[model samples]
Target: MREPAKSKAARTIEVINRLAKAYPEAQCELNFANPLELLIATILSARCTDRQVNVVTARLFKKYRSPDDYAQSDPSDLELDLKSLGLYRNKAKSIQSCCRRLIELHGGQVPRTAAELMQLGGVGRKTANVVLGNAFNINDGIAVDTHVARLAGRLGLSAHKLPEKIEADLKKLVPQEKWTLFSHWLIWHGRRRCYARHPDCLHCEVNDLCPSAFRFD
Candidate 1:
């Protein structure tokens, strides 16, 4: 039998409820002391793991203190600092350009709103949402990463291809207060059980709640 497409609210609530129950201690995995640090760390986190980001940021933070530090550094040198992560060239350029914008317009502070942050180089919806939820304490929206996107489909929560569309669907299901935690929980579950290659459905805390779970068979 064909399954019905879930409404946005239904999907959001399911993702939120299951993920929240699965990972009760879900929080931002990235380590940062302030909003500026979180913003910079989030930039470095593109296409990289949080552990890798933390390793990179440990040294990068010591070398660069503020937006001016990033803005003033030579791009080539900054790229070398991030060489271990690879894709350093583009990431370095983005960090410099984005920091320059922060200095020139926002007076060295990370912008809170997604629209404003998106104006900065490499600041997409995910990055903007991370800053909003973590740095600003406004959990208005979920930041749909690979984990959230994949789990949303596997759990029959969302069928959307685009992260933005999936995020829209999730937004409708989850209340605003739970958005950030819900996103974090899914990320935790992905890392802990539902890996890209294969999911450890048996180890999953909310496997019973998951539509994709095959244990019933």
Candidate 2:
């Protein structure tokens, strides 16, 4: 039998409660001191792991302290600094272009709203949501990363494949106040237990609540 909307909403909250307890310290793992640093880190994080991004940013942040620094940096030097990461050249271009737009449009300040964030080069819906939720503490929308998307499908929260659609489905079930934390919770769960290739269903905290539990076994 298909679950009703109200019932599913209730179950979703229960799942959130359990995951929250399981991963109390889950958060934006990419280290940053301010909005601009977070914004730049988020951009560099595309197609890369947060751990790797943090490693590079440890030195990168110290060198490029502001939008003006990135905007004015030599492209080759920036690329050389980011050479260890995949797509170093493209990421370098994105950082420079994004910073230039930030300086030109917002006076070198990271925008507070998602719409304005998306307007910058290389900043998409996912990036904008990350900045909004983590940096600005605004729950404008959920950032549907691969982890969140996978967990949503496994938990029967959404059947959609597109990130925007999955985000819409999640927003309908999750409370507005919890929108940001919900993404963090699902991301933490996905990383810690509900892996894509081999989910630890036997030890998963939300196994009973999940629809796809044990199916991967």
TM-score of each: 0.91, 0.96
How much does each candidate deviate from the true structure in C-alpha RMSD? 3.1, 2.1
Model 1, 216: alpha-carbon shift in Å?
14
Give lDDT for model 2: 0.92
Can you give the lDDT of residue 195 in candidate 2? 91
Q: Which lDDT values do the candidates have, in the order given?
A: 0.85, 0.92
Report clashes for each candidate as comma-separated counts.
2, 0
Looking at candidate 2, what is the lDDT of residue 79?
Answer: 96
Q: Give the per-residue lDDT digits (tens) of candidate 1, residues 1-217.
A: 9787666556556656776776788899999999988988888888889999999899888989999999999888998999888788989998998999998889998888888898998788999999999999988678999899998887767889899999998887777887888888888988998887778988777565577886333
Best by lDDT: 2
RMSD of 1: 3.1
Q: Please write out the lDDT profile of model 2 over residues 1-217, one tens digit for every residue.
A: 9765457888999998998899899899999999999998998888888899999999999999999999999999999999888889999999999999999999998999988999898899989999999998999999999999999999999999999999999999999999999999998888889998999999999888888989986
| Model 2 lDDT-worst window of ten | 2-11
